[model samples]
Target: MGPAGEVLWDVALPASPSRLPGATMAGFADRGRTPAGLRLIPPPAVTLALVFGPGTVVLSGAAGRGSVVAGLGFGTTRVRQAADFSCVQVRLPPAVAGAVLGVRPAELGGAFVALDDLWGRDAARLAERLSETSSWDERFALTDAVLARRAEAGPAADPEVAWAWRRLVRTRGLVRVERLASEVGWSRKRLWSRFQAQIGLPPKRAARLVRFDHAVHRLVAGQEAAFVAADAGYADQSHLHRDVRAFTGITPATVAGEPFLTVDDVAWPSSR
Candidate 1:
């Protein structure tokens, strides 16, 4: 339990390896920490996260409301809060890149932005009401409604950006940005601009996040650290250590061994 009396769900990812082909596995987290100021927690890896319930609002530290609800990238971190209730969170696969970052799951590496910017006041209220409902069917209906609105409001897709994103995932971050730009036939600046507009972050940052996410999945599933590091494209164990520290504020070894709430936690899996 946290400082507040609210209970927390024992979050876990799906156990099936067959479901994940190029990215980390997805998980669900239901937490009711407190209705206080936002609390920032480092994820196990870079991922697209969804705030699926009411009362909760994710805030960005650097960009404030402007950065709160977007599909943030790998190194980005945000403060999370629930005004008077709890919230549910769902993780997205790394391969599933977002198209527009302002409100939809189509954005890649978008930062946390304001809920109002994405869902608006009415949608937010609907989510709040749905959170109090007991039936899964009701919840699903509410979710569908919200998704429909989001789809309607989402930004148009750019084939070039989509193609580049696909290539990046297929190559697992081994491909260079310049090569991607050339393949898309867009100037480097043009590519970056389009990517930022649609994905919230540049392609390189998204790629790194995806790469780190892959490494974390392997580590969590009992893979050897050294081998996982190599496969993830690190120069060596030390390079992997640096990458983790840069994004998560911890070394790979510490993360390999523990359940870390923040990047600073020791790298060990949870005792349970």
Candidate 2:
């Protein structure tokens, strides 16, 4: 129970070996009736939430307002319902999100949209399927199969863009954009345009987000802010503070205490 006597159950689902690359899933079940909500900090990957409970889950952010199903990518922090909610969160690489969600990452960048608006009737069918199933495992299986089918049916990202995204993640966003562009045989301008169109954020901002994600986790792990700043490639402690505030509207100390990040290591052990 929380201070408000709220009960929250968190379930982390292992990625099935058969699942598509660059996709991960988790489940959250909150039973509190306290009109609770949370500030969802923006991460590097695109996010999709499937809500299948009596409680309506509303998301307000760059993408705008929505309830039931929410889609967010490459944007500012979003506020979502925190109690009386049960849902599954799917994290997808921006490259594949366009294929799976029928909308480019750039379209949803820095905003929230109703999933039904994007997926149409398929979204309704999915909600019904998930709600009808009593087993969490069943719900996960259904979602994975749906995503796999959609991804296979939709167009894949340009090879150059996909390669660049992988490299960014591999290097923790420390690699130079120019270097990545050259390696991918794309001019800097070309890379920037395509990346923004496909992945939502420009290369430079994406790198910062990826690096900031690393630093935030370290802080949540109890590392000192100065050390995390230096290690994360920030110019100084103040730089880290400014970046954290920009992303989460909070200071590093406050970010270090976020329950969302604190539970991440346990829930997504291989998030890095």
Per-candidate local distance difference test: 0.50, 0.75
Candidate 2's C-alpha runs over 4 A off are 1-7, 33-37, 61-83
Model 1 quality (TM-score) = 0.64
lDDT of 1 by residue, 16-93 (tens): 221222233222344544334323433422233334443444454533221133354434354444443333332332
- Highest TM-score among the candidates is held by which one? 2
> What local lDDT score does residue 143 receive in model 1, on the 0 to 100 scale?
44
Local distance difference test, candidate 2: 0.75
